[model samples]
Target: MPINILMPALSPTMEKGNLAKWLKKEGDKVKSGDVIAEIETDKATMEVEAADEGTLAKIIVPEGTQDVPVNDVIAVLAADGEDVKAAGAGAGKAEAPKPPASSFETPAARAPQDEGSAGGKTEAPTKPTTNPAPRPEEGAPAPVSKGEATHNGARVFASPLARRMAKDAGIDIARVTGTGPHGRVIARDVEQAKSGGGLRSPAAAPAAGPAIAPAMSDQQIRALYPEGSYEVVPHDGMRRTIAQRLTQSTQTIPHFYLTIDCNLDRLLAAREDINAAAPKDKDGKPAYKLSVNDFIIKAMAIALQRVPDANVSWTEGGMLKHKHSDIGVAVAMPGGLITPIIRSAETASLSSISAQMKDFAARARARKLKPEEYQGGTTAVSNLGMFGIKDFTAVINPPHATILAVGTGEQRPIVKDGKIEIATMMSVTLSCDHRAVDGALGAELIGAFKTLIENPVMMMV
Candidate 1:
């Protein structure tokens, strides 16, 4: 049998990726665990390892191909002793078998039920009974459903039996609540929906006028400007994903920002002293040289520890309180920015944090980070001090309750004990997800950070 190689999902939320490059070419023999290609996700570019030992018979998707859907076949491999040419010829002819039901869900199939019921009820539908109708064969095609309705522009998923019941009852299948596996609407769900219960209307669809006007097409926008006045730069997969995610975050997450000014004189002095005392390596380079950002990271970590309530992520189920501070530091790259995390920042030493960040920043610029290096974090810190940006709020990244934006440190006059004084001050803004961190709690968190940063000795304690 000819083995098909599908594009792997680099992250939980990754639906598609760019086939950045292929390490193995056609006719190359690959062993299990051998890296065969590099896949570019929104956050990073990762190497994909082959799972089967075989000869690469054909490359269905070439390098630099963007937006390749997950599980779509990108290559074909011939088994041992099999003819490579014959396997390549059969690639497009034979369809690959469907994966297990647990792993074969589409985005629409896993969407949550719509808010606002017919009778002002807001409770979710109860789970359906376990005595489901006998499922088809493991590899059998799923039965088709009818009535096209969209949630977030994706088609709704329902069992064929549910569609039939919904059609007969004059109920919209999209409005019927799905309680089956991965929220798939089954026959019983549709039957229950007919009784004016157990159904959820599409969240994106409004009962009155359209929820939102459609965006102008590219051609329409381009027509407004003179021809040859501007050059069109095609969007890469990363840019598209970033735009979609940021838009979704701003729209869905309620953000509240708090700014604080901290005196960085002590921190700067401490950093200089610490760097001077650092040990040298075999190359005659210092083993560790800490930056102000390192102190900022440590301060934020300790602050989260002091104000544990602020270190949380908001979810539909409940607040996720993290025990450790996984601090993500935003690093700028060619196309966009990425936040590579230093896990357990509270536990790691300042020198360790500095070294780790140096490595992450270097790899980040090269687009060589792994998914785990940049994916999830309890909180984030974005420093634009180097670029001379002062006092700016950052958008709250999802799954992170707060992100601290640090500005450049400069000398400024200050009132001390009713007298005038000059001190090095840095302005910092904390952008919090209002759902997760309340205003008072966010203030307390930033206050803790300010205290640790100003009194660098306290951070050592």
Candidate 2:
């Protein structure tokens, strides 16, 4: 039997990916865990490992194929001792290896409960661990195309991984209906379907409410511009993901802004003193060059610890109060921006934070960051101070209760004992998720941040 090589989902929010290149050609010997191909997700290009040991019988989805949906057959492999020629000839004709229909059967007969999809998602889906069998069995069940059902000219909407799971488990995906967004099947649904229950028929699904009418179509938007006046530039994976996540953030999270002015004279003086004392390497490069943003990050992290009530995430089940301050710092890239987190920022030294951010920013621009490096965080910081921006508010990224936006530090006149004096001042805005942090709680959190930021010495204690 020919083993189907489907596209793997590299991350939780990944739906489609670009098949960048294939390292092995057809008729080549491949072993389990061998690197076979490269898959380009939203921000990173990861190497795909071969799950089964066999000969590459066929190449179905060639390299450079863009927007390839997950779980679609990309290649075919023949098991060792099998007729490679016949396997290559049959290639895609062979159905995927499904274990048993009973695998999807369950003890409890109920509809699959997918919290994010059944109603709506509080956050993105969790990445599933997919370890496919390395060999083919003697007998497998008949397969359905991409987990589709045969009825009413209707098609099944399922994530690529769900379809693959159904095929591998010999389950009739049509019988195990979807509970994901817009009735699409997801990994959790498949897991619940394993019990031979918690699945409904596709025909029983509720009808779609209406077409996506709130937004204009691509064609209509294009028509507004004069013909040939502009050349169309398509969005890549990063841009698309950014647009989607930001849109979701703005729509779902009710954001409130709190702004305050901080006297940066102390912080600026402290940063210079710390940088001047930093140890230098043989190449004359300083071990650490602390920046004002580094102080802000440390201050915000400690402030969250002081005002622990504001450090929370809102879920339908309950509020999540994190123990550590995982501070995600926004780093601008060509297509968009990425937020790489500094784990346990409250405990780390300013030098460590600066060093880690420099490395993260360099790798992030090259699209070399792993998903875990940028995924979840208790809060975030977005500083446009380097760009000379006075002040601006930021959108609340989900799973985070608040984000602190920093503006440039410049000389401003201040009154001291009824006498005017010039002092370095910076403006900071805190965007809070109202559901998680109320006005007073947010104010308290920001106040703590202001205190620490203004008195640079306090952060050390």
Candidate 3:
């Protein structure tokens, strides 16, 4: 039997992905856990490893193809002496292509629904939602969730569902008009349709019938808007998953942001001293060199110790605070970003944290990070300091109550004993979810972070 290499969900939020690069070409031997390709998801470019030891036989979706949904086959790995042709033959069937938006009838053609009068009960217009069939090509105008109407000779679109109810109630879509994005008709349009007692133009009367149109390819319609060359890329598996999860998170989860500045003079000096004195590794490389990020990770671990409430997740039942400090460190990649966790950070020494960070960062860039390294964390740290960012807020990674955004440390003036002096200052912004962490608790956590970062020795203690 041939093993199909399907696109793996690189992140919890990833759905569709683009094949960034193929590490192993066809006819190459692969071992279990060997990296096969680099998949660029909305969140990050990640390594898609072989699950079984076999010979790579066929590459299905070639690199640079987009909109490959999760679990879709990208390659075939056949066993020793197996027939690659037979293995690939069974897997070569393509799924049905997504329908184009233009295939559906126009919203104005849909039958109207009944609405009650204003004296007691009133009719309402139906809202339109696209029951989009399968995958629509890129730029396939998504079916309007609302209906459409003609107002003063101008055709305005509203949700199909909304239009039905509005017409049944004897409401004039033209008089009521629209309030949706791009001046489209929405539910609000139906509500105001009755109140809009404005005079109707003679042309406001109903049309003879729906205007029928000829079928055309999506490429043809898109060509009309072309000033420059534009192409529709299908959503890869990873991108689709990302879209779904982010939509859910944004809709259901309430997010809040908090920011603070930490003095990094002591922290910077500590890292330099540690790095200078660190021992060499078996590979003759430095075993441990504490970077500013290592210190920040250590400080964050200590702060989580003081304010355990911040290291928690929200659930339907109640808050679930984590006992351990598994700090995820955000790493930037080609398409997006990934946060690989430094497990048991509270117990790990600065040297160990530094080593692990170096390893993770290198592997992350190379698209070799394992799934375990990128998932499940109590908190997260995103450092833009290396990029010279002054300060900025971060979106809360789901399930983690807080994420610390660290900025660069720059030399600035400070008052010392009534005298002007220079000090190194850095800013950090903590994004917290109110449902999981209260304002006071979040503030206390930042305060603890400030103390540990400024002292630089507290982590050692």
Better of 2 and 3 by TM-score: 2
Residue 403 lDDT, candidate 1, scale 0-100: 95
TM-score of each predicted structure versus truth: 0.76, 0.75, 0.60
Highest TM-score: which candidate? 1
Task: Write candidate 3's Cα lDDT for 238-310 as tens digits.
Answer: 3333443344345445777778777788888888887788788789887766678888998899899888878
TM-score of 1: 0.76
lDDT per prediction?
Answer: 0.77, 0.76, 0.68
Candidate RMSDs in Å, in order, are 11.4, 11.5, 14.8
Q: Give the worst 10-residue stretch by lDDT in candidate 2.
A: 113-122
Order the candidates by lDDT, highest first. 1, 2, 3
| Predicted candidate 1 versus true structure: per-residue lDDT over 1-461, tens digit per residue | 99999989675345556789999999999999999999887667899999999999999988987666567899999999999999999887323322212222333233321111000111233555668757878746444334355454445565544566688888877776554433445554665566666655556342221122234455666688777887766555466446544554676678999999999888998999999999998998998989999999999999999999999987543577999999999999988888999999998999999999999999999999987888789999999999988889998877688999999998999999999999999999999999999999999999999999999898788
- Residue ranges of candidate 2 with Cα displaced over 4 Å: 81-83, 93-213, 217-223
lDDT of 2 at 137: 54
Name the runs in model 3 displaced over 4 angstroms.
Answer: 1-92, 96-251, 280-285
Ranking by TM-score: 1, 2, 3
> How far in Å is the alpha carbon of 225 misplaced in model 2?
2.7
